[model samples]
Target: MATEEVNKPPSLPPYPEMIFAAIAGLNESNGSNKSAISKYIESSYGDLPAGHATLLAHHLNKLKESGELVMVKNNYMRPNPNSPPRRGRGRPPKPKIPLPAGAVVSPARPRGRPPKPKDPATVAAAAEVGPVPPRPRGRPPKMARPAGAGPVKTGSGRPRGRPPKNKTPFAVVGFD
Candidate 1:
């Protein structure tokens, strides 16, 4: 019978200097992500510990957080200390105005989409058209009550259960 081999972590000398060297290489070139930085480390230092890539990634993130580096567009780069931080996407929300303490807040506008602005043509044509009644919640009341639905035999519309037994007691004849 053939024996299966168990995988083990690669054994190498603990040299963290390699990580700093990789960072330097990254800075020299255009900014790169974690994987590229790891490859650079491996290429520079022949073989490393099994989790060296993860270790490098941790150091890179730490550097970024500590302000040694800046993460720009998903790549780590040298921080431009002279430049101000850029604002993020989207318009800022309107600031809330402070309401006077005893004033009752008027009822909120109805939920759901705001009414579309009325077009001049639509407004002019609207008098001839009947105003659309607000829709009801459920099944739309079966548009025109489906042609031939014989007076609904109602009762929760559930299937009937067991039929009732014979109402009168059976009379037994006595045998002498």
Candidate 2:
């Protein structure tokens, strides 16, 4: 069982480790430039799949944000030794700075379809930003009757029933 577990392949690639290794392996002077890191990864392992570059970039960017790596110009670099090491990940502390009187901090939007703003003040403020364009109403204005092509005879594909011949009106439920 132990050997089987060890032999089993990972369902997903270890992207974080790969990205970190690629960045760390860079020469101090190179500053872990993105292209260099990507090339290194390809050479060491295999080509990344289509649309994967963005995901890989996100990982690298997170490292830079967390102070695990430093960015200089277009390249990322090792953090300075003098600065204290970054803390472990968890909820970040809230801002302690106080807002001036009359400041309004908008609440965080919930995930998925956002609710419309109902507050009159918020509505007025939004209106000031730009003129609200009129919405399209009813059926869309169709193309000009195809330049004398004549109106399309509308109705189902069924043929019209034969007309009654007798002068006396027969019971009729429908019309063509």
Candidate 3:
């Protein structure tokens, strides 16, 4: 039994690898459709699991998502090495061009909207005497209250709670 097991062809590779092989074997320039890939797998690998179709579909989708395989018109093919990488959502970034020889590259500016440009004279003075300290982020701290200060009063002297409703009714004018 041990010898017979050893003689049996090496167990088939995992489903994904098997599927890739099937696609390669078909060698269709336009790429192989799911049905054709399934047929090739069935014929080339005789010991497929009972859920072979499901396994193939799942792995194909995964391969497509991971950029290993591309699906076009429901047919699967390996991605071309020379093809440009797929762009994500939103506008694609502009391509960077090579700088000419002996070009002087400016230092990269800091990321967010740049600070408003300072007057050149102020900038020159700043470079000689160290940079101005950055201002603190939020509203300036409230002016410190004097230790002896009392609650400030509003100009009108009326006390604060809601006033009671008036009990009187107004006379109504009727149509003649």
Candidate 4:
């Protein structure tokens, strides 16, 4: 017995055309993200009929390679122009330092000690002067308090707990 051969139509072209058509539709509807495109195809074509992920991925890669789509830093894919410039995959750029108008910068100063104020008398005496240096960038290192100062107490004035000897012991219910 001879078996009959069934002829099937070739699958649609999986190229830039279909991808661009989808992208054009997205642009027309102002929905330009990968997830949006995925959702559109899934909804329009009914869940992609399995194994379509590879095809979808291929088309998306082609679209990206052809500059029709770009992936944002956040992993969202949109039109190339809409995506922000990538600042490398490493650490973010250091924030720019801003300076006030007419401000002068000096060399880094020693960690401790405030600069002495300039005096007219010292100037008249022809005292040698040195350039004042820049203060340490952020806050000054906290100073260590004197040892005898004891634990600092809050303003509530509750004598920061009495000396350990003054603490009264309470009877334990189980022991009692």
Candidate 5:
């Protein structure tokens, strides 16, 4: 019975529970970083496996992803239940206001610019004066250039802004 007891392996707590214990026991106001947490665990548990470091990293990532742990500035700590959930990228949605019973909600206006209202007097005048012809939909056909006209002269095709500096010797003014 004594030999059997001597040969038995030591029991270890779950990685998550060990992590929580480390954070709590270390009592860091900001939080404990990965190195600190790992050190604490190693010192607390004497019989950790050879791959303990990799295992710890995997569990830490899992905890952070699942919201079990909050990481800030590379340090890890438990999330505060009292704190509001973290906001997403953009501005938060506005809270909806409840309408009272029997309240009438107006329908949304049509999207584009509203048609211009006709003047009441013009409308009545038009009715008595017979219908006017509707204007053509697109720009009127461009007037034909007179037979004598040709393309107007525009100074060489260069853009019509400030001229670029001239490199020619003629452009240089001599004070002498």
Candidate 6:
């Protein structure tokens, strides 16, 4: 009787699958050079949809942080094979703006001289005008009724004018 070989499904790696695949491919192809790994990753995955490169960079950084990968000079990174080394000095410190301790900053004062006084003619014209009277505060004064006119009677139980006529004619009477 022939023995049947059992095939097992591959297990997923704990890290990001794409990155793991990329690292494995790089190791197989280039024998584990960081530059080669970087080149392979760029060539294989860099042309993916726009945001994928950023995601790939983030995953690669996470792998490096977790001691699963190592970055070399010139932006090259590969699967870590040795003890994690301390990171090199990062970008130089930004130029410092040193403020003195307990410094009190006051509001900036106007820079130039006061504007020149109004022209002589304008000043004289302004001086001739008297102070304006204060306006009455509440609603405006009601309109005045016409002189010698009384209020006209309206509907409250008072008789209105003649009733309206209908289209039908009443009996016609001829009078000489």
Reference-based TM-score of each model: 0.35, 0.39, 0.47, 0.31, 0.48, 0.28
| Residue pairs with backbone overlap in model 6 | none
Candidate 4 achieves a global lDDT of 0.62
Candidate 2: which pairs clash?
Answer: none
lDDT of 6 by residue, 1-176 (tens): 23333443343343266566666775553334444544665576544444555665677678778766665553424544665565557885688887799988788989989899889997887779956689999999989878778875567865678767778869989999
Per-residue error at 44 for model 6, in Å? 7.3
By TM-score rank, best first, the candidates go: 5, 3, 2, 1, 4, 6
Model 5 ranges off by over 4 Å: 1-5, 87-176
Alpha-carbon deviation at 25 in model 5, angstroms: 0.3
Q: What lDDT would each prediction earn against the true structure?
A: 0.71, 0.78, 0.89, 0.62, 0.93, 0.62
Model 6 deviation from native, Cα RMSD in Å = 18.8
Tens digits of per-residue lDDT, candidate 1, 1-176, equal 13333454355544445555666777656577767777887787666777776777777777766676778777766767898865556997889999999989999899899988989988878877968889887885545767688796869777799767888978998999
Error of 5 at 173 (Å): 40
The best candidate by TM-score is 5
After superposing all C-alphas onto the true structure, candidate 4 shows an RMSD in angstroms of 17.1
**Best-to-worst ranking by lDDT:** 5, 3, 2, 1, 4, 6
Which residue runs does candidate 2 get wrong by more than 4 Å? 1-13, 84-176
How far does residue 18 in candidate 5 sit from its true spot (Å)?
0.2
Off by over 4 Å in 6: 1-15, 28-50, 75-176
Instruction: Estimate, for each residue in 1-176, the C-alpha lDDT of model 2 and write its tens digit.
Output: 99999976545467778877877776757587888888888787765667667877888888888787777888887777998777657987987998999999999878898777599988889888987788888988867665788867867866688766869768978977
lDDT per residue for candidate 4 within 14-109, as digits (tens), equals 545555566666664343565666666666545344666677777777766655666555232456575565444678888989999999989898
For all candidates, the clash counts are 0, 0, 0, 0, 0, 0
Candidate 2 deviation (Cα RMSD) = 22.3
Q: Which ten residues in a row have the lowest lDDT in candidate 2?
A: 7-16
Output the better candidate (2/3) by TM-score. 3
